[model samples]
Target chain A: MITSLSVQWRMDEFCELAGLPAECLIEIVEQGILDPGGQAPEEWLFDAAALAIAKRAARLQRDLEIDWPGIALALSLLDELEQLRAENAMLKRRLGRFLQE
Target chain B: MLEPQGSSMDFKDYYAILGVPDSADDKAIKTAYRKLARKYHPDVSREAGAEEKFKEVAEAYEVLGNAEKRAEYDEVRRYGRAGAGFEVPPGWQRSGSFGDYAGHPGRDFSDFFEAIFGSAGRAGEAPGRGREGGRRGQDVEMELPIFLEDTLADESKKILYQVPQYDSAGRRLADIDKTLNVKIPPGVGDRERIRLKGQGAPGIGGAPNGDLYLVIRLVPHPLFDVEGHNLIITVPLAPWEAALGTKVTLPTLKGKVNLTIPANSQTGQRLRIKGRGLVSKLGTTGDLYALLKVVMPSRNDEATQQLWKQLAEQAGFDPRTEWSKRP
Candidate 1:
């Protein structure tokens, strides 16, 4: 869960890079795919992670034929799966020191 | 995305690419696509050339996965074969109209695909009311390997990577090498992605440039293992050192420090060294764990053997009692 002082992108840049409309970005924000800062769309500033998620969501829509809600769910599950796998690997490595087979 | 060069476009057998027979049904084709896509997806796979393979698969599916494009491509396919220089039959007019059915605009298809399906504006193309006169450049992503020791402090690193350049018509020209002295912030985790603004491919026309995303890959340390921000090091101790407490000099990211091994400490015991792991951009530091592992002498002399025998008799300890009780 280590994070840095991320660079932020304005709404126009976010939309341009993510290849999604403002409404779609609003929908994604509403659906919790991204948690960009600011109150309104005009003031909204996205980080690199948000842009990456948006791009992935767009790919799911274009390539996998998934809806926004479905993409959000899939991304969330995939992120959780990745975290669990990392934690599992670390735990296994730690356990291996004591339980040699 | 590498189209065969020369006047004639190479024939791309969509059916062959999907590994389906000519008579394979739509369900079978879709199943094959799904399976291959899952296997080759650049985001999921670590296989070399996976991104290229994914683009190929997506292009194949773009045609074969659709009804109209498949039928139209099928008519063209009858006159061509895979890997051979192909030309559309003279006076061959496609009966079906491809009306933007293949919709992956960001992913550019081959010239042959454009020749068959009719060329459309690339996906990244800005509409008439775009902020810039043209579309921004395509974003680039590349792996950046960082040493575990480097994560302990902020450092400047020189990085060189290639960015693809495209023309105004969205035709790939050549890759341009970009060199930058990137300021790597502290405590960057493995697989963490950082974006550099306007560091990607140059924009076409008067549009702004795209960004470059650097994915962090931590190189395996010789002595330390990374667990998130924390670090682990295996500290080897002599049997006597473990039995009777000893002060050992342990290596930290900064320098060496004294660690006190407790009396009768067992193997696999861990002692945490506070604030010695890694530093984050916010000035927060993680702790390092020293894992104890007691090692015996590799070779024993006669006098050493006699001493060991005397100690064994004096100790009278059986380590395998639990193993004997386990069924």
Candidate 2:
């Protein structure tokens, strides 16, 4: 089946892929690092984006020695920075189209 | 960092991997590790082979990060040099022992590390070891580049990658070559990673295989720029065409379509072509934006210059009025 963005992994599989325990995933969810679809962990479904985010959170905890709260704050800031950069580039391209001599 | 010479194990240059001098203090080593880890960590960096680079850095820090381990490694490092594999002295054995595993998941230390630390606690001890109690294999990740057109429909892609194999004792073995045919569902975005279960390295003693993660990278298109599912194409227009609107044939992803440029259309004007963009996984097609760009003739003849001069004088339009105003 063509299931790229729509593919959702159950909690156990997500934990295995991310190399974290269920408690860690819960901490991440509680800290707002990821929001899997369902309300309960057993019924929760995590998409590809959540997988990437979970992995990043784990790395920050292990590599940089950052705590969960610190990682959550850093991730939100980094995401914001990426969004601003994309918007800035688009705006520059649009302005260049008109300002060209 | 280490290259095997003959029967002897190759000596690794941990200093070179972490880009630090032998005299670097603990604080300096930690700083370098943090900087490189941030740069090469696969989760954050889009650079090619960043994950491998990160592993090398991590291994270096694992040895140098601890004071006792660094002292022991330094003694052996004095007898060895990078790229020139030397046999261990007949009676020489390093004094430091491998620290108890802190349960770092999915990380495998290099063979050189095992040679130095004397493989007390190695790969096979991971949580999901083989079905017979050996650790599961390591996961592998690679980037997959796809064309914009390829994302329009479901397609099968053939990929070839190397998977690390291990002996029954969890000793590192030569990498095994593997090929797979995977179906890429439509609407994958740039940098999105898809996980394939049991597609990574084979586990020792029939343990569950590791997963293979494919990170999608969208190749830059020749004609279009992607914003979400929307496509933007810049259309060049002659001065007269911009002054007096004209219909022109434009190229779409599938075929050519006639686009009517409205009269007095200025540069930077955008015309939206509905349902001509990429199809999302939700089955919704986005709109295509045709951005207008007015261009002047490369070489203006005397006659053309005279005609332009007359029009410029007659129109009496101040193009720099906004710039001329004192804000």
- Cand. 1 Cα-lDDT: 0.79
lDDT of 1 by residue, A1-101 (tens): 12244778898767877778788889899888898867888888898878788888777666666688887888898888888877787677666655546
Candidate 2 C-alpha lDDT tens digits along B182-207:
78878877777877877888877766
The models' CA-based lDDT, in order, is 0.79, 0.80
Estimate how well candidate 1 is docked, as a DockQ score: 0.30
Which candidate gets the maximum lDDT versus the true structure? 2
Clashes by residue pair, model 2:
B129-B134, B129-B135, B129-B136, B130-B134
User: Which window of ten consecutive residues has the lowest lDDT sum in model 1 chain B?
Assistant: B121-130
TM for every model, in the order presented, reads: 0.86, 0.84
Per-residue lDDT of B218 in model 2 = 81
Cα error of candidate 2 at position B10, Å: 5.0
Tens-digit lDDT string for candidate 1 (B61-155): 88887787788888998888887888877887655355444355667677777777755522334322245557677788889999977777767
CAPRI grade, predicted model 1: acceptable
